[model samples]
Target: MTVSAPIASRADAGGGTPQALLRLDAVGRRFGDTVAVDGVSLEVPAGEFLTLLGPSGCGKTTTLRMIAGFEHPTSGRVLIGGRDVTALPPQKRDVGMVFQNYALFPHLDVWENVAFGLKSRGERGAGVEAAVTRALGLVELEPYARRKVQALSGGQQQRVALARALAPEPPVLLLDEPLSNLDAALRERTRDELRALLKRLGMTAVFVTHDQEEAFALSDRIAVMDRGRLQQVGSPEALYGAPVNAFVASFLGRANFLPATVDSVDGDRAACTVAAGVTWRARLAADSPRGAGARVRLMARPEALTLAAADEPNALRARVLDRRFAGAATFYRMETEAGPELLVQGGPHTASPGDVAGICLVESAQPVAYAAEP
Candidate 1:
């Protein structure tokens, strides 16, 4: 059974020194000739929600399976609370896992399903009843406790699965794309509820998802993976505002990459020339080298480029090509006189197609720069 109560008393529930609750040291997994996960090392501190985010076939699911003891790593160690449990089976690992499919028993009611683990693990009589009730209440599903799994809505069924997994209150929770099966709106709502619930319980969790928005919404930190390797790991803001590479920048959010040649460097900022007369300042990645005549890429979000007066500094003459109207924002596709296309985000555009305008890069907004791809 999952360990519901704290295994040991922590100094603080959620605000301690951020002790490592889970650690993966150089973990690797191989399936025949294919390398599923390659030398991934990560440490998830107590009460911090970390996400393994990537596209399909990126080894995110493989990594999560390894941690859950569903798949053994070909190399390295998996530790929980300073205990090496690399060779332990899933049941012995003290982890509660919620899979993509709810994995609920169709014949069992919500209460019985949630109570299965507890009862099987020797919890009896009043203890099993109380634990099931508490778990159902946590998911706000007590009213549906008698309902069959197939009779519930997708969201309700998700709640039941969550309740079942949480009934054991394992010190660490492993969720593998738990919301992926729901509709978009339900997924959003469920993710919000999941984040709120985990935070309230101060539970340490490792979530895996390919949905960038979901990862940003629910994780304290995200580890972006690609092709069986970790690309970057950081807080949502840090990853979005200051991506270490092109993949991280493009993967995290919408970014418009502009090719440039570095003209000069001063400290963490550099001057780059995008065109014959268009020179702009951009922030370099923290560990990137500063040098003259270096080829680099400047990344700006759609919102970072706004309509400006024709005479404004760093403004480029462009003609609107198309406009996409989103609910809260409008995206404009424009072609610059300097021969580059740009996307600018605004609300209710004043300029129509074929209208010439000045698109200015926000001077104070330090766009992220990285070494250009070969």
Candidate 2:
């Protein structure tokens, strides 16, 4: 049976019922001659988990800072619950921010740390104590309320930081690489914990990370950014199944791109010639507007390709150059006689290096195709 629950701390009423907690309308930012962000618009619904994902220097962090009121946009507007707050300061924005480095107070104990925000606002008595206890319990750090900030583990300290942010009961939480410093095991554990906590709390959140796995795991919606512009924005599945361009094709995951010319289209199915040397029927992108004689990059993820013999339709005969084992799956780099390099993946039954194998391209597996750059 399927289970259902809200993903935010307060989902029903805050930030307009998950329709939109915040929106960036044609927001742009510039530094001297370089434009950091350009005419980007995005809506973050309440109780939703959205991630800003991209490589470093791609304006992901700058976008988060703009929402935090730390960086002002060159143009466009920043809205919180549909109210324009482009010129508001951080304090007036009512947003809690978590940094890559957990910025906890070394001088304060766990309870004190969580209560710091309330204390600063002159909140006293049961209100302060109730908020602190509730925040501590949400992060599962109630047992460590008396622990010293410097004495906790990295993961624990990070939770404490999250609890501290939550104590203020902000409508939105912004996380900037909050788990980067943890070890592999801890990272995985924290990732799961954060997901559960966000859901249980029904709290709207925006997370920033360059890690694709992290973004995919934590975000209900992901906005892929590159070089000061949003490449694509959608659910992780949408981005993976239908990327827009070559940059996005290579970034999100492995893809074998074959130069192909469209031969014909029978509704959604199109027969295209690959590498100008072979013909294969490919499934076109969903809602793809371009068609017929348009030079396109035929793309397939590593999981999509299979090794096969020469003269086989949608198949490639090549010598395996290298093999890398990735626990659950194995990756193979194959070199074709046509000089086109392809990446192929096989599960536990993958081939070894130096083997001559015929790679199979699952005929039914259709990937998004992009217009080749001239």
Candidate 3:
């Protein structure tokens, strides 16, 4: 997957690299006194799947609307294929949008619904038919093209919306939680199908969702937003492994934050004392305090911790409080002697509730330390 970068121009300064097909240059929007989006800039290379991920009302949907020309930005520009389209209307822009509701016409059948966009653009007769056929074929809904959208399943209705969007052959596609209506099992299967369909079509897509798992599964790169501001943008693994801040760390997954003080700093590493004489070496984040004695919090994911012998080096003495079986893995809730409770993910039936256990960071775990918030 191609990673996204902040490219202001069509290509790099030297014009040696492939141009970004979509660019949002410091775009912003306001609803009276409330800022919906603030100075969000991003560049998406052709065929890259970029997801805007955040909690509710974090400006992801607003950003998507700006790209789709449904809403105009109060400041900055929107560009597609290197051309500024900030002032263009929805139909004038070469982009397709799959709305959250699927927005299928109840009166129309799948074939007519899929042909709606093409027909609205003044396509006539066989041209419209061919485009609709091709779009349905792409989504493997050709057999049900004559079926009314109301008769289709939630997953199939979503495909009709996608087919309608694709019939226009837009270079850029915008998806706004297209799978939100489906059941959990169906959503998972549909997302896989959606990603495969988009990749096969070489579509440059911008997806908006609050679900981190969906973002992780579908995106080549994720742009995390918060409080109407862009926080960080990177590949899923990059963002998950080395988040820029506490918000990103906690939002991307379950993180255990232990209050600690920095004992020392050696380059990018920090020795942090979580409790009296209990020090753990952690990777220092960019904004982490450098000097010794600085208050900080050590962050470790549940999966990064393992059960160990009580006397093992760097192990924290803990007692298993409870356990939950979760299919492939079991989760253990433990309270450390250091006063912090931690969650650890391990194999099945390792320890039961009331069992005294030792919690240690796994070898591959490089815990991060962040300067404690005021």
Candidate 4:
């Protein structure tokens, strides 16, 4: 069962409008001679959760800062609800921000911290109290309203920070690795709560993370960035199933790339020969190169392969070099005479180290092909 429901907030009330809630047009930022973000462009629809995913120094954080108006772009425009806000200061942007450290005031109690946004905007008395109470309830923190920020646990502090950000009911929410400070187990649990809350409230959010699992779990769509440039933007399933390039295929999940030379193209399928002159069929990307002899790569996930009998057609004999038991599954590092080292995963009864096995790619594998990087 899914956790999403029909969005019924202000964002969707104007049902006929075609404009995106947030738009970035060729945005770029430079610091001295270093390019921090370059030519990044995307559109986020209202009530959708988008995640900026990449490694450190890849400009995910810089992009988020630009959206929040904390950093000005050098070359492009930022549009929120169809208005250009590139020159606006952080305070002027109606964006709620949650940081990695929570950033809650050490001396302020939960209630005061959450009410700060409303109070700054001239709200007071019963109205302010009511808004604070609602925000705390959304994060399940109403019982801890009088607790000091320093006295709460890490997860509790994160909840307080999130409550403070949402108290003002901003149209867009930006989170910069908000769960990074929590332990592994707590981070997992908190992420679940966060996703559910955003969906239930019909909130539009952009989350930044280097963790692939977190991005996959929370985003309706993911925008992958590298070296200050936008790489690919698509739904999580699309990004994982049909990655645009070698970098994306390897980064989003574990993929074994086999070097091959294209022999022929039949519609969207390509026949390629690997190391032993064994021909294999692979699916072609929409922009895949079709020229014969063009160097390309065949990508297959570890779970897509299985063990076959010695005489099975389209199978290769390999020896398991290492085995790791991971409870529900067993991972094997297998070396084949047909060439590259392949990582294969199977049930707990899979091959052990020193065992010889016949490895075969399942017909459902649908391996993707990409031009080999120079």
Candidate 5:
């Protein structure tokens, strides 16, 4: 029988710290020679909204489809609330699903579509009607309950779709780019509304989206993927402040990679040489595997590098390559004699195309090392 989505205190539903509700253990999927998802593993806590974020062909959607049972893993397992669901069919696994297309029954009114699950379960009468009302109310679409889905606007249609999924109150909700079809304005509005609603309802949801901003805004934790491989999974701050490698540092935002050779070490500060035969001191984790006399790459973010008056300390003299005006910010790309092209953000500096300036990287900014790939 359909029950009101449990009103229990859920972390996102304004309750407590959310706990893991789903886990994918080294899950993988392959089609012939092309792998869709590679040994991807992650956990989503109950009532926490998690998003799988990546670019096209990054296997984020494929991962979501696997969880929805549209595709099966070629290897590994799917666990929901700690139980293995790797072999379960879509219907057998009590999961609520929202699709990118807002697939609603054209023939059925909003109320009917919301109640379709209950009807399928052989439910009848007042209980089904009450559940349908509650679901519609949840999405603030109760007024349109009797309207045919075919007659609704895209936003309205999506609301109906959400109502349908929520009506059954499944232990888990799977959203596959649910707001991708909406316009930018509507998309932002809907995303915020959806996040709040999911929180208030205490729903354990897995959201899939390619928009970095969307993932950062809506998710409690984000799982980043690339070429079917899980890249990094953490809060947005964690991913931004401490990226694990070059790909992550580059993908998450702009970065400057300067080639340096270790001169000496003072605990974490390794005197390293950059381009132009200049040496700079950089901090490294004590446990860093980098050794003296070895070539290393120094990483720092745009904000970390600032325009400096003198070419001293860890300063690099750079010639401006390009300047881009991006509304609230202007990013400048400069070619440094000692590092890969560096990007600087958020200063209203209007340096002409060929102006030269000294750059300063805040101490300990992007103190990371990459094992030089063989």
Candidate 6:
């Protein structure tokens, strides 16, 4: 796959006026002397499904809360539909939120639970009933409308919460790991269902999760965070194919980082020589180190590598340290002669543990080279 350059802003790329429905301008949050979030800015256009992805304490949840008017930012502004809502309360923000726990009322039936949000907003009679019915229909939970929340399955309960949030027809929806409580199989099924439902409704949504697969599966764009700061933001393919830094490259998937030095620069490509004295050409971004003799690291995904004859051109000699069957693809762990360990994924091959093989990059593979940190 050809690696494209990281996009700094969607608006900048399109060369048009910003059409952001939800905007966070240098948002920051603090508690006592500890900083929870710092100087983060982002924009989510209308009808876009954006995900805030990171490990725990990375401020993704806090950022979502700020957008929903639950936690106030110490600095910057929050705007929804071109209106500043930084000081507004949750109910006044016109944003729907589905908590991680599904926050359902056990004593209430599905219909009543779905109607609660509208009723709390002083909506009653025919309008509340109609909104409730529409929301339930969207989630396909009308059959369980009369069933108690406690009697419903985990997935059903989650749908009830989603219906309640959507009943009000807010312009933006915030989901906080709503599928984390479901089993593996159910989570996968529900994830597909959720994506379909949201796309059908054209609902502008911001979802939060630490699972990279989940983010990749659902998001139109993903904003990755680390240490309470924004790391990178882009589509799944852009982020995975051309990571801006080492953190993003390592976090998105399994990659083999080979230490190398720049041997030559040719426009957007660089020739780097590894410790084993093997030279490889890798794609380079605009900001990548261009000077010859500059230290850098080549990032290659396991599936991009192939096994070949040791005498083949642009091949590295390596010994297979281990091999494992993984259904469709087998994984081979190898140690290069110069001492760097690498992983290759391919169809079943004759190579096994304790066997010597040639590790070569596939013709279509576009390995990225990042400047090594000091």
Alpha-carbon RMSD to native, per candidate: 2.8, 3.3, 4.0, 2.7, 3.5, 5.9
Instruction: Please report, as a residue range, the 10-residue window in candidate 4 with the lowest summed lDDT.
Output: 1-10
lDDT of 3 by residue, 84-138 (tens): 9999999999789999999889999999999988888889998998888888888
On residues 146-176, what C-alpha lDDT tens digit does candidate 5 reach at each position?
8888888888899999988988778889999
Better of 4 and 5 by lDDT: 4
Instruction: State the lDDT of candidate 6 residue by residue for 117-219, as single tens digits.
Output: 8998999999999889888988888889899999988998999999999888887899999999999999999999998888777678999999999999999
Best by lDDT: 3
Which residue pairs of candidate 6 clash?
Answer: none
Can you give the lDDT of residue 99 in candidate 2?
92
- The predicted structure with the larger lDDT, 2 or 5, is 2
In order, the Cα lDDT scores of the candidates are 0.86, 0.82, 0.89, 0.88, 0.80, 0.88
Q: Residue 6 in candidate 2 has what lDDT?
A: 44
Off by over 4 Å in 1: 1-15, 286-289, 309-313
Better of 2 and 5 by TM-score: 2
lDDT of 2 by residue, 1-374 (tens): 11143434344444443577789999999999999998889998887889999999999999999999999999999998767899998888888899999888899999998888788878999999988998888888889999999999999999999998888878789999999999999999999999888777677889999999898889898999998899898999988877867677688877788777787878877777665356677767654335788776788888888766555655666898888889888888988765778888876455667878777767667755666657
Error of 5 at 270 (Å): 3.4
Per residue, candidate 4 scores C-alpha lDDT tens digits across 1-374 of: 22233432566676765347889999999999999999899999888899999999999999999999999999999998888999999878889999998888888899999998888878899999987998898898999999998899999999999999988888899999999999999999999999999988878899999999999999999999999989899999999988988789899988998888899999889988775546778888765689888888888888888876656676767889998887877888989887889988887766778888888887788888988867
| Ranking of all candidate structures by their TM-score, best first | 4, 3, 1, 6, 2, 5
Please report how far candidate 2 places residue 213 from its true position, in Å.
Answer: 0.6
Q: What's the lDDT of the predicted structure labeled candidate 2?
A: 0.82
